[model samples]
Target chain A: MSALPEVEIRIGGIDVGVEHDALLASTPGAGACVLFTGAVRGEGGLGALEALELEHYPGMAEESIASVVAEARTRWSVGAVRVIHRVGRLLPGELIVLVGVASAHRAEAFAAAEFVMDYLKTRAPIWKKEIGSGAERWIECRERDADAAARWIGQHTPTGESA
Target chain B: MLKLRFFASIREKLGQGSLDVRAAPDVVDVASLVRHLDAGPMPGCAATLLADNSLVAINRQLASPSTSVEDGDEIAFYPPVTGG
Candidate 1:
């Protein structure tokens, strides 16, 4: 018998470091932790950016991330996973997302962290509107993100490396 | 009845977040639900129906066009996820 992987998903404006500490505290005997942060860029190809308005389907957004983290646990020896995404109005350079994974080694930690982020981009029920240069528009989804997440779909088994 | 919800640009364009409508016999999946919402001249809905980026979810689960949905289920449609 084994305990389920620890998972945390949050939607709000808060520093990712705060969530990282909480994720680490939840997993005992994990030797490696990988963390990633996504920040609102100060500029875009269209023009200078002022801020971004993030909207999300409340219940669905949380559930989607939970599913993503659960998949990561199945693919790796992940002990704990935390995903924090901020909604509402945000200025340039503000943190918009965070993903952290705790594992017994670096490979699993890195792979699980990236996997969580890739799925979050495409699977989560969230959207972003760019506000800049006297204009605003919804940011379109990127094809590269789908490609990133696709790479994980069939490769459920580890690549024979020491993961 | 099925609760249909929209978010982000779609919500702004539609001028409402949600609407409850009696599900037709064919409205048993997400694709049909989208078609049901497009029953009127909703320009914004046209994008969601035509664009490849639009995503759908039923009962808090990411769903595809063919995903089965039941009465009282929540169906949400939104533009491709941009959040990290």
Candidate 2:
């Protein structure tokens, strides 16, 4: 097997397809590759939004995500994990983050990708603000997000010990 | 000197990313330090760091109210994250 990076984490905006290609390259031997992308959308009262602004702790945000990825690695027999997050003003329909996982099986890839994203939403030191016509407000963290992340607390692989 | 940082709504409410505070000797833990910073009604000056919803990190690690801190430590206070 050729040497390839196990983790590909970047804290900036980039072309999603290109990053996905890189992830695909890193997962040469994996049987399953799952990738998830998040994009800004105007929902509910945000329909009139002009843009969504993101802010993050310079060094802390990246490290926080890496820590979560490491946990996913310890739990699943995954081959690769790729994550990229964007910071700054992003218009509606612009991508915000991407998570990809490659593993020997479909279950592992799907779970790890979901795991990383679930943790990132509530744990990463990044924040979002909605901007509209002459108005701006910080996006509040949703209770459902915390629940989503928390539900995985005691979950484990079928053949592995509890995580 | 210990570096105190703020982010998101807290940074906006506090009006700065970082603060220069030569932490007092009496300040031993995060809770006390947060109290020290929640000084007044002035924007960009005093922050309600002790609020229940406020989150903290010490040297980039998620920290709690009881997290011990010293002069050289880096402490940050921010709101619950909203990143995906």
Candidate 3:
């Protein structure tokens, strides 16, 4: 049988740039890889946000993410999954989160990456507070996020099966 | 004893990270747990802190109101996750 899927979870800020090369070198024979990076925005959506303060349940946050990655593995033939979510104070335009998935095919890699991100947004035990212009407010989950995760609920019957 | 933990905005508002209280007869599930907390020191907490958007987890797993709770379980309440 193939080796167990690789999973990594980081809770603090670290150099995520090196993770790409690391995943490629570690996972031999993988044909496709997908990487998604989320960054903080300075303006627009949540007002003139200067920085984001992310808070998470110390133990539950990591556990929740691990479970999300595990679920992705069951639905797709993923090889290595690395997720890093930065907590504490994060300035605008800073890297907030990274999701990398490697697989033998592009379809599985792409689908799995999206699936992991969708679940992470809704299910993870992390929250964000926007700070800027003498105002600070906690951000709430968007309806679209729940809808995104809901789309994958009944579609887990396998690749070729009716979804 | 049942543990009630709060995070993010709810934690900030509640002014504490967690509280341990004996699980009374009515505190057998998340729904009942909310009721117990609501009637305590933090009045209107169930309405504000446990709003419709609040997320609940039992034993570190995401759970719903119907999920059963027992002694020694950790119940965490927080706002919707915004992490990517």
Supply every candidate's count of residue pairs whose N, Cα or C atoms clash at under 3 angstroms.
0, 0, 0
DockQ, in order, for the candidates? 0.81, 0.86, 0.79
Which residue pairs in candidate 2 have backbone atoms (N, alpha carbon, C) closer than 3 angstroms, thus clashing?
none
Q: Which stretches of candidate 1 lie over 4 Å from their true place?
A: A1-12, A156-163, B24-53, B64-69
- Per-candidate local distance difference test: 0.77, 0.79, 0.80
Candidate 2 wrongly placed segments (more than 4 Å): A1-12, A158-163, B39-47
Q: Model 2: per-residue lDDT, tens digit, A92-125?
A: 8888888888776788888889999999898889
Lowest lDDT sum, 10 consecutive residues, model 3 chain A, at A1-10
In candidate 2, what are the lDDT values of residues B8-78, reduced to their tens digit?
A: 89887777788878778667999777666565223334346767898889999988999999888999989
Could you tell me which 10 consecutive residues in candidate 1 chain B have the lowest summed lDDT? B41-50
Per-residue CA lDDT of model 1 for A1-163, tens digit only, reads 1232343334457666665676677778777788998999998655999998888888788877888888887888877777778888889988888788876777888998899999989888888889988999889888899999998878865542463
lDDT for predicted candidate 3 compared with the true structure: 0.80
**Residue A21 CA displacement from its true place in model 3, Å:** 1.9
Error at B24, model 3, angstroms: 2.4
lDDT of 2 at B1: 86
lDDT by residue (A52-125, candidate 3, tens digit) is: 88888887877788898899989888777888888888888888888888777778878888998999998778
In model 2, how many backbone clashes occur?
0
